[model samples]
Target: MTDALERALASLDVRAGSTRRHTLPAGGDIVLPAGSTTLVYLLSGEITGDLALGSGCEVDAPTGDGRPVSGRRTLLAGDAAMSLGCRRLVLSSQSGAEVIVVTAEITPSEIVASLPGTVLVTGFARLEPAAAALAGNLGPRPDGLACERPGDTVVCRSMIRSVLLSAVRAWASTGAWPAPIADPFLARVAAAVEADPGHDWTIDHLASLAAMSRTVFVERFRDAMGRSPAGYVTEVRIREAQRRLDAGASVSEVSRALGYASDEGFRRAFRRHTGIAPSAWRARALTA
Candidate 1:
């Protein structure tokens, strides 16, 4: 299960946007806007909040003992909270508190969809010490010199990435996400697709690999994976394209490697899956 989550996290394209520190006075509440992924780590304070989720949103949180907790409403010092696809987040502090909030845009949407809409990790400092260490050093500089020095952006981004990774690892450890493909035959088909995403995957070929008839394979694949084989193949290809692009591969190179007949074909498919052109995506990743 951890391996599957690692693969999913590896495929995600996380672009950290801004990191801000907020001080909430007693009885004050703040409303965070929607869009992108948001992480809130309590530096030294207490907060209570409600998440307004739009359609298709899911929420999960784990307590200090790594047990799943539902409808979590409060966060204490050393706790970390995350939300995606929420209409807005309303947080209020009964006693004054301070927090560091980071915003990021993570893609492809399918991968984000697979994650819970909200994740609150209690005792984050103990559960993810490395991330806690990084977070401890993050905030507005005392002199108000924000990212003004050489390599500051890169260093800040690296810290944000580490913190985000730790939060995800914590959530995944609780076994809250969906289970992996259960059927052995379907699992084999998924493995093959992932192994060679550029292959000319057809229903017949995949069914043959699974040792099942085409109709049976299609039905079972959808049942186990929640999508048709062709859809899964497209997803796998797009995931690979994101990975390669983030690794500094050119658009044409990724196109050819993914078995697309032309750059335009790959561009269209990539846009359809990720809602952005591959080149633009790569550029954002580079600057991020």
Candidate 2:
């Protein structure tokens, strides 16, 4: 499932190479930002853990935020149903299982214009249909890498996109975006965020750009994607840093591009989220 979902994102325009795939021991908790939606495909075993809007925000998996997302006709056969405000999403891994996840902020502006559809709006978020569908199909890895299967990655990604395009058409025809996928305000904010990751960003600047009160922006941002404006910016910065790192940018150069207070600050945030120092991370990406 994880592989399928990752492939879905891989096929899309938003950071195909940016998707992070990792393996964790059972019962281990991993924190991910809500700046993007996640599609988890349980691999080698099933991972039964709480799905949350950030580490602390729990929306009741069975009946999230006064909404129910299970056993619905349009919802996938094995899919989950819940109100998905764009909070920085987090998932805990169950014992003896590895999960595949694709976390990203692929707004409608990034996709809707390209693919005309019902355009389900969510808070300040927009889940590009292709990416969302790929997230949905994170299982049955494709065929490419020489691991357990041949062309696993390639085949899985191709099939995942096929499913994603199909699901978008089906859901858009039904005329309503899913609860947790995305909403209106979220969409607008995504447009803004995608416009400039290099902005000298601040909560106030984001609040103004989002056209909301500071408190409102902060709360809504937290509720929708799980991270504060600053937090979301940090995530975006890291993504940018990864690109630079992959392209052979020095850590200090990346810090300047992402508007970090300093290179040290970027290093701290990068390590905290990815469990590796930036210098080391750059080496890995470049080497890989």
Please give the range of 10 consecutive residues that has the lowest summed lDDT in model 1: 53-62
Q: Say which candidate scores most in lDDT.
A: 1
Candidate 1 clashing pairs?
58-117
Residues 130-239 of candidate 2 have per-residue lDDT tens digits of 44445544543444233456665565545443433433333333322222326566656655664577787777777876788899989988988766777776666666
Query: What is the per-residue lDDT of model 1 for residues 1-288, given as tens digits with 9 covering 90 to 100?
Result: 454566667666677888888888898876667776888889887998764332222223334234334443788998888878465777899998888888987765455676666777878888788898898778795467765679888888889988987887777766655466678888888888888899898899999999999999899888878889999999889888988888789999999999999999999999998888999988877776
> Pick by TM-score: which candidate is best?
1
Q: How many angstroms is residue 114 displaced in model 2 relative to the true structure, after the best TM-score fit?
A: 22
Q: Estimate the TM-score of every prediction.
A: 0.81, 0.41
lDDT of each: 0.78, 0.47
